[model samples]
Target: MAKSAPIDDVPTHGEGIRLGQFLQLAGLVDSGGEAKEVIREGDVLVNGEVDQRRGRQLQVGDIVEFGGRKARVSD
Candidate 1:
């Protein structure tokens, strides 16, 4: 089994940040366009479901995986 990376300083309560921004912050995808491409191709997963929206709001406790890297939002 592959282990996912840990997200530091997860937000407790907020409107949540943009999915693309989050991916960039985590150093997952190289650029916004790349993120969009990967998302549009249905290569990204959120909470075990395929999430193709680049602007999707992600909250704490949400799990995101892409490009063999995984991240879990923590509070």
Candidate 2:
């Protein structure tokens, strides 16, 4: 069995942020292209379900998982 990823809190400064943008802000990926690539390849998840939409809206409490790292949206 694989170890679960630690939950990290990500604070949003506005209404919400896009998945790709959030991934960059969380330091998950180095560039937008990278984020897009991973997301398109089904390497990212939103609240436990695979989400390939890079422009998916992320609000407070939304959970994002990528590369074994999990980030929870917060105020």
Candidate 3:
């Protein structure tokens, strides 16, 4: 069985953050290149739905899940 990622509240020190960047800031991925790859491959989810846009703007309270891990945006 796959291990569940610990859910965390990651603070975004701004009004919004890009999906690809958030993946890195939240420690979901290692690099911007990896973030783009996973996002393009339909491996990333926003608020529980697959979001392919790497530049998708994320706001406070938004939820992101990838690679069995979950993170919530915070201001």
Candidate 4:
């Protein structure tokens, strides 16, 4: 099997965070507007699937990938 990309753990400030917000919190994007743009351009993934919903709720253990990097949500 091929090795998966490394995943960095990202802690949320609350119980959960929206995909767009998570992007910013994870330092994947510089701002919320950038997150929205990236999501709209199909540059974001959730749990290995392409997701375009900026408001998609993300919780612990959820994985997000962009720019060849992955981030795993942690409580």
The per-prediction CA RMSD against the true structure, in angstroms, equals 2.8, 1.3, 2.1, 1.5
Per-candidate total of colliding backbone pairs: 0, 0, 0, 0
The TM-score of candidate 3 is 0.90
**Candidate number that wins on TM-score, 1 or 4:** 4
TM-score of 4: 0.90
Where model 1 places Cα greater than 4 Å from the true spot, the runs are 1-15
The models' CA-based lDDT, in order, is 0.78, 0.93, 0.94, 0.93
- Candidate 2: the clashing residue pairs are none
Give the least accurate 10-residue stretch of model 1, judged by summed lDDT: 6-15
Better of 1 and 3 by TM-score: 3
Q: TM-score ranking from best to worst? A: 2, 4, 3, 1
Write model 1 residue lDDT over 1-75, tens digit each, in one string. Answer: 976565444443455687887777667888999889988999998888999899998888787888777776655
What is the alpha-carbon lDDT for the whole of candidate 4? Answer: 0.93
Model 1 RMSD, rounded to 1 decimal: 2.8
Q: Lowest summed-lDDT stretch of 10 residues in model 4?
A: 9-18
Cα lDDT over the full model 2: 0.93
Model 1 TM-score on a 0 to 1 scale = 0.77
Better of 1 and 2 by lDDT: 2
Candidate 4 displacement at residue 56 in angstroms = 0.3
| Candidate 3 lDDT trough over 10 residues, lowest sum | 2-11
